[model samples]
Target chain A: MWKEWPLVAFTIAGQMAVGFFLVAGFPLFLLDGSHAVGTTREEGLAVLAVVLGLLVAAALLSFFHIHHPLRARSSLVNIRTSWLSREIFFELVFIALVAVEIVLVWGVSAASGLSRGVHVAAALAGILFLLSMIRLYMLETLPLWNQAYTPLSFALTALSLGAIAAGFIWGGIFILLSLAFVAAEIVISFLLAPGHGVYRSRPTPSLRPPADVPRYLHPARLASSLAGLSLLGAALIWGRGRAVEGLNGKEWLVAAFALVLAGQLTGRFLFYGLLARPGR
Target chain B: MVTQYGFFFDAAACSGCKACQMACKDRNDLEPGVLWRRVYEVAGGGWEKKGEVWVPSVVAYNVSMACNHCEKPVCGLSCPTKAIWKREDGIVFVDTDACIGCRYCEWACPYTALRFDARTNTVSKCDFCFEAIDAGGAPACVASCPRRALDFGDLAELRKKYGDVRQIFPLPDPSQTEPALVIKPHRDAARAAERAAEVANWEEV
Candidate 1:
């Protein structure tokens, strides 16, 4: 699983970028002219630019997953049939759409209908990108990853991290929402663990005896996430406006983000660890 | 006619010598961890009680497996690059130049036949000794099996020669891939799973 760091980094980073975009844009589109949780045009561009940068970074990291990076051009050759092809294709589409959003936001007001339309489109594309990612892992031969928890866990990863990151910039309310999602994600992660056993959890094929699912790392990941949730919850209860990094965000929020990120990283590594067999 | 190739294994006669595995590795020059053909040592069953007397009823058997070259190859169907494909002879081959080394096919395979070759930086598997087959010779593994446990022919021919019984203990359900394999199971194979038999060697394959 450690050897699959490239994939772990690629997926989480990509999902995080998409999550941020969707969560931040949700209030804007859902409500009629709601800047209540929106940033200024310049700030929007800055945020979009950051999201674009993360998307690019995630794409670049994924190159490390394949042994022959140069041959990757052929990956799109089978999008009609292969979920992996569809995954890469959608990711590229999402990235391109985000770049377009960044440009449109730079050119016009954030409140303009055209910019908003593109923003909504990009968010949908980001979602398709995530759906492709989920399908890519739900292989029939690999029962460990084939369960319902895969989609649940991935959806939570996107929503929890996205909601939390959005809360970091938008408002205290988003933080509370993130707290709920983080708690939910933690539960889904626990259920996804093979040893959780009561569910559809099946042992991955292995040459060795059945594996102990991340003896130390699994608990540590859950602990960090729980701590993040607690801190964020406490911040909503106590801190009104501390002004983190000149932004109307709490310092505790930033700390919680770091802790949550660490938890997600560890959890992803454990996810890869589940692949005991069925080819590799 | 579209000739689909296949393999036949007589598990009743196999002695688990592993020569077929070695022959395949040597022929393919596969890396240390890569195996085009593997022999799973399925052993299970325990003592049986017969009217207050204990009888040792252990079941053990060897199953030599390679690419079954399924009619519906999941690896090919799931390959993002279309790098894995089947010949008219029903032999699945990974295109060296086209494969991007994504290895999604590895996960889709039921038989665990596709192995990542570090040297080529791509997934590879048994070509069914296509060159040898075209020249009217058997695959290295089939030829090397001293116990005369292995055979190969057209899928229909193999099924007709040796009844179409592909599933046995430890082997995945045949419907998953519709693999072109025929097996003559060992007598103990019938009760292997019920008796708690499993592949004794997880490391060797």
Candidate 2:
């Protein structure tokens, strides 16, 4: 399972990228059809570039999950029946739409007016991409991942990370949402996940370790989650105490992003660790 | 006209010597970790008190399994590259040429029929010995069983001969993939669930 690290990185990075875009870009669409904001158009372009870069990097990393990279092109051949194929299809579309939106708004003239439409389209594609990613794991055969927890955890990761990234600009509302998501994730994983373990059920059991195995939850994963939430909470308090200033929250947000990202990576690692055959 | 072939297992007659598994591995030349057909040793139940005596209530049996080549194979449906496909005779085959080695089919198959081949960086499984079947010969596993505990034929005929029981303890529900196999269950199977029986030999399979 640890060998599948590339997949863990791919999914978390891709989800964070989408979350950042949705949280940071939505306000641009809401601000009365004007491009004016505290940050320069160049800065907005930089943010979009960051999101695009993360997604592209994620796509590249996912290639490592396949043993034969040359045959990766054929992954989309079964979109009709395969969630994996649909996931790749939607991810590519999301990336393309984001690229075009960036070009229209930043590379070309802002007077083109095509940027907003493209941004909206890109967001829609991102939503679909996220959905496909969630559905890919909600397989009936593996009851552990087939629950509401998979989708919920993924969505929460996006929301929390995105909110923290945009928290200073949006004030305490985004920060509050981030905390709420984090708290909910902790509650569910600790409280509700035990009953789902494989040894506990027959036909609808959760994914678990093989026989005579020890340790239900990995210590590293739990530690990472604690560390991440602590960093985010510290950032929240720091931002709340400081007077609003341009780029003041930027540094803290970056710190929060790095720590949260670490937490997400470890969490995803544990998620893959749950992969086990039912009988033995 | 979609002719389906299947295997029939008489668990009552099996002796758990693993001849079928060895025969399959030998015929397919499987590597150390890759097994197309596996025999699971199911054992459970502890000491029980029966009024005036303490009695051992252990129940044990062996289930020899391979790809059932189900009617609605989740492995094929979940393959992103369409690498796993079913023949006209309902035998599932992995197109190693097209497989990207994502191992999603391995996760999707409840029977865990698919096994990774590190040498090829792809997955392979039982093809129902299609080459021998086409030539009117028994599969190596079937022919090798000295006790004649295993049989193979058309799904309809196997059902007629063996009755409709397709699942035993630790085996998943048959409705998931509509596997074409049939079984004459061991006597211990009825009490397996109550006794908390599970597949015991994990390292070998």
Candidate 3:
């Protein structure tokens, strides 16, 4: 049980960081009206600061998941064959790149070429980070995780949340796009679940502990299903009078976020718990 | 000194033709339902009624992705049996003979770039067409990209040519793992933020 805790902690921390970043960061990057709340500089910095903080926390937490955290440097040796090594390398680079971007944003305005370069670098770094994360699962060879959409869904979740965060910050037409992407992500993740046809692959012995047979639903799985439903419902009511009239839209977004967080947590739980030990 | 070989995807010119996907299949002799590379069309942002015209600007970005052959790969780190390893030139490859089919690497990776060949019960991905590269040729996918959207060379050279433009959107939550591919998005950073806000509002509703 203790052995699994590292995985559990890592999963929870990673999911929380991702959730917060998506909900908070997207508005700063994609919203236009956000400038009205505060100066563009202030709002952007707020978003960047949150993103940086969450990333750092997630990185540190990832170490706990490793059996030998001290030898973490050695993991980078196989950049050619392993996605984990690349994931770590890219994450370190992202830290440095985001730092540089923050500096550029402060030293130079949003319009400056330096800031732009940093943004691009950050974006590229983000791609690497996401790919590495997905590859980590792909390398597992678990039938449930070996789907084509695994990585796509992982990346899409981040993109969706980030877009939503940006909508909050900018408060322009971006809100609609962010909502749409969230809806799409809802559909994608649900489809990626184990029972789905796309994810169907060879089966292995049940990893569930013996004797705890209450239909064993993974927490992440339950959360994901709930999140999907809530997000879809939010989409349906988004353009309605209630949404346009008051804080109804904001309330729905909060609810959707809760569901998303639950789903992410569930995913993390399943990620560590459902290991397919060879010859089991 | 470490040298890594990988592919650069130009989303603007991708055209979504999927020639690279086909070329990869033919060259690698992959079985059906298995793809080394996939092209995804990403559309985002919303429409609003402006003064005279309904200004609806949506960003449609196409991503042609495969294994990034990262500088630090998660697959290798998680493999209990040293089945996956990095080539000297920075290409990651799995030795079928050594792989125990544990699937640890698949779980470690964030990109899902690696696939398990059920026939062999092992994993595989783009080898950078190591055979062709050794014979003074490019990977089949790069060679087949008619739009000139894909290129291969020293990582430094490609970065120089691209000039690392700003506002290129990275995969979400990059802090989780480091990936190597770079991008240059045409959209403005401020604009992206606005879109995010809108989504947040919608979700709240």
Candidate 4:
């Protein structure tokens, strides 16, 4: 399952990118809202660059998942039926729109209506990309992935990661969302996930055993990751009130973001490790 | 009318001998760890108490399977590069030239039919021996079956020759892909699911 690192990176990075865009770009629509305070054009552009850069890195990593990188261009041929094709199409569209919006904002001005329009367009494309990505894995044959939890967890990952990365604290809304998502992910991992059946107290007799137990699935490591995430969420919420002398609020926020992102990365690794093949 | 080819397996007659499996590997020249055809040994249950005596309630059977070349092939529908496709003969074929070896179709297929070919850096699977079929010969698997438990012909002809049952224990529900293959189920098949019977062999194909 570790062999599927490319997929794990691709999905997480892409979803985080989408979430960052949505949270960071929301202020473009609020013409006279004070809640958009501290939401500057430069910060937004930086986040956009990060999202695009992550997406490009994700695309490159996906090439590693395939044996023939030279034939990667042909992956877009089956848009009529394949979710994978739609995913690529929407990702490209999202990237292109984001790039154009960046040029408009940087070359023109942040207050330009045209850049806002492009931002909205990119957001729509990002949503499509996320949907396509979800559908790509919700295959009926693979009982392990064909569930509502897949999309729900992915969406939550986006919301939580994106919220913090975009610096949208929202009077502790981001922290609460992050905690809630972490809890939901824990619940899903133990209960709703198809692969969770393997670790059941009385596992049903199946063709194959739980393929491999990765380090992240170890009880100790799982608990530690969850605890780390909870502490990070608390720190983000508490650190906002107690300002360190040298460390600015943004620095603390960045630290929280890095920790949470690493936790999510480990969670994704465990997700891929649960190999539940149909027959054998 | 398009001639949709298919296979018919007499599960009652099969003796678990892997001649068909070997014939297929030999015909395809598959490398180690790659199996185009596999025979699944379904085993489950144990001794059960029947009043005053312990009865052997155990059940076992074998299912030799390859690609069914289903009418609605999920592998074909799921291939991002249009690498997997079905001919008018209903034989599903993989285009190594187009396949990037992403192996998404491997997950999509219920049969576990697709195997990664390390040598070619692509996915490979049973092609139903279309070349031999075009030359008016049966597939190597069918021709080599010692018990004559396997047969191949047009889908309509196979359906007429055998009953309409297409699914057995450990095999997925046929509705997903509408697999063209037909089967004469083993006597223990009905009880297989109830007893949590599963494919027993893991190491060998």
Candidate 5:
């Protein structure tokens, strides 16, 4: 149970941090016809700092899962061949690029126009950071994580969260995009679900008795069901309102978060429970 | 004084620019995806109320890393084919020609730095830019970094420069391996605890 918590916590923290940064940082990138508003260069950079900091925190936390944390540095030696090494390498590079942007924003006296380029660079770095994170889970040995859609799913999740947060902050076309992403996530989740027939063997009966079986499956199944329902809710809200108003954005965000949390937890549980052990 | 090569990474001054990465790639003529060095951005602390002041302090530390080339290297110890070796200068190298493409060294290294080249069927890693160091030029990365975040010189000098300061924080866990690289963490006790908790959670799989 303790072991599972770490994975759960890390996933939650990572997703939340991505959401926080996206919401905090997107307003800076928004152009108002010919002008931009709502974010200063310093604030934009502070958001970058927060995002990079969170990613580093996530990376450092990942080290604990490894048997040897001290030798973690040795992982970098394999950039020539391993995607794992490349992932670490790119994460480091992305962090560095953000640092450069921060320095240029805070330390140097740069023009706002120059700062726009930095924003674009920061966006590119964010993309790299997300890609590196997805690649980290793409080990061929881990069948559940190794699927082609694993990275795609993760990327979509991040983008969905980011778009939702962006919609809340920016409140325009971003809302539509966020709703579309939510709808897409619902379709993906439904497609990805393993039906009862898909199981390689029968599920072990709950030793606690039949009464406990529903209790165990309730959260997972309900969460899965809620994911689809919430997505439909989001589509309805968007179609009727056209433009997000009142609490619409917040409702969509809350719904998306719930669905994603439920889906991810269910997926993680299934990954650990059903996947064949390497030796077995 | 006997001369030895190592890195002098100023944690305080490092802004985590990846020019070092680019420079290393250019100097080594590596393919697009290859990187001999990496920079890690480490941060700590959270918002806490100290009296009337709601202090939300966060500090960023940059770790520009490469092969630590420890006095004792596990990669060398675990390589069944004797492909990995340590030099007198405290640099670790992989003899590609002698490598059997077995990934044992990759698992042996805690740093995950040993890469198995499928095309060459060999293992490879940083050689500390031997040709440039031999010519008295700084390693390509050290020379190219605009911020001077990385400096390569005698290990003793680096120790002396940083010795008086508080020992670096969160040096990789010391149980399974001893890394030559030293880290100077920016955060204090509370932050360390938070980070430790975070790490504990991440290991779950």
Candidate 6:
């Protein structure tokens, strides 16, 4: 299970990139409308560049998960039926769209108007990429990952981390959004807590009883998440208290991002741990 | 019409010697950690009190298994590169030439049929000894069984010869892949779940 670190990095990094991009781009979509390059355009382009960098890193990390990285081009061969194929396809599409958006918005003056449409398309692609990632693990054979927890957890990872990353940039308002995502995460955690280790129902005939999801990992994930939640709460209070000369709340948001990202890393590890090695 | 190939297992007769498993390893020249076939030792129950004294109430049996070359073949369906494919005679083959070595099929298969070959950096599994079958011979594992515990043939023929007992204790549900296999379950299997039986041999397989 620990050998799956590459995959862990790939999924988490990709999700965080998407989350950051979506959350940061929200202000642009809401605050601007005209074809003219707004004051925040440079900052927005810089943020998009960061998102692209994260995606490229994710794509590179994923190559290490497979043995023959050179043969990765063929991975999309079965897109008609395979979720794995669809996932790679969507991720590439998201990356390409983001890169194109950056180039068109900054380099080509004539193509400036197409930037919003491209951002929207890229966000949609990011969502599809995440959905495909979820679907890839929803194997009925593996009851541990097939549960509703997979999709819900993945989506929340994007929202929570994205909101926090956005808060790091957009500052004041996004802290509230981050808080909402974290709250939703806590609610879902509570909902899934009851069936943490037990496989009460047999979805299909399993060769052996479904191995229990690690009891130890859950507490660690919960602790980190709750700790991050507390920090975000503090950050909110700190922002309000330190609201002097145009405070964007970058001070506390960075720490919250680290804590939440660490929590997500632990959770992703636990997710892969569900497929215990030397499987029964 | 596609002639789906399959396997038949006689849990009652297996002695847990692991000859079939060894035979497969020898024939395929599998890597150190790779196994094409395996013998599972199912054990459960502890000392139970009788009228006067404690008696050993262990329900133990051995099951030798290989890929069943299923009808649905989830491994192939989930393969990103479409490297794993089924033949006309229902034999599933992994086209290593095309495989990207992602190993997603490894998780997709419930029977744990596929194993990663570190040497090839690709997934490998039992192919029903298609070459030997073409030359009018049995699979290495089936032929190597000392007690005639394993059998192989067309799925329909195997079902007709043996009863349609596809599921047994510690074997996955047949509906998942509709595995082309039949079995003669050990007597203790019916009570395995109630007796809290489990596949005890993890290190070997």
lDDT of all predictions: 0.80, 0.78, 0.58, 0.76, 0.54, 0.81
What TM-score, over all chains together, does every model reach?
0.93, 0.92, 0.49, 0.92, 0.46, 0.92
Across all models, the iRMS values in order are 3.2, 3.6, 13.2, 3.3, 16.4, 2.8
For candidate 6, lDDT tens digit of each residue in A66-107?
999999999999999899999999999999998888887777
Best by lDDT: 6
Higher DockQ: candidate 2 or 5?
A: 2
> DockQ for each of the predicted structures, in order?
0.56, 0.55, 0.03, 0.59, 0.01, 0.56
DockQ category of candidate 3: incorrect
Q: How close is candidate 4 to the true structure, as a TM-score?
A: 0.92
Q: Which stretches of candidate 6 lie over 4 Å from their true place?
A: A34-39, A108-113, A190-215, A241-248, B47-57
Candidate order, lDDT descending: 6, 1, 2, 4, 3, 5
- Backbone clash count, each prediction separately: 1, 0, 101, 0, 20, 1
B1-205 per-residue lDDT for model 6 (tens digits): 4399889999999999999999999998887778889898988888889999999878899888888898999999999999999999999999998898888988888888888887788889999988998888999999999999999988888888998998898888788789888999999888777778877877778
How many angstroms is residue B62 displaced in model 6 relative to the true structure, after the best TM-score fit?
1.6
Q: What is the DockQ of candidate 5?
A: 0.01
Indicate the worst ten consecutive residues by lDDT in candidate 3 chain B: B196-205
Q: List candidate 2 segments past 4 Å from native.
A: A29-40, A109-113, A168-172, A196-220, A241-252, A277-280
How would you encode candidate 4's per-residue C-alpha lDDT over A150-170 as one tens digit per residue?
788688778767767654433
lDDT of 5 at B29: 74
Tell me the lDDT of model 1 at A116.
73
Which pairs clash in model 2?
Answer: none
In CAPRI terms, model 2 is classed as: medium
Better of 3 and 6 by TM-score: 6
Residue pairs with backbone atoms closer than 3 Å in model 4 (clashes): none
- The candidate that wins on TM-score is 1
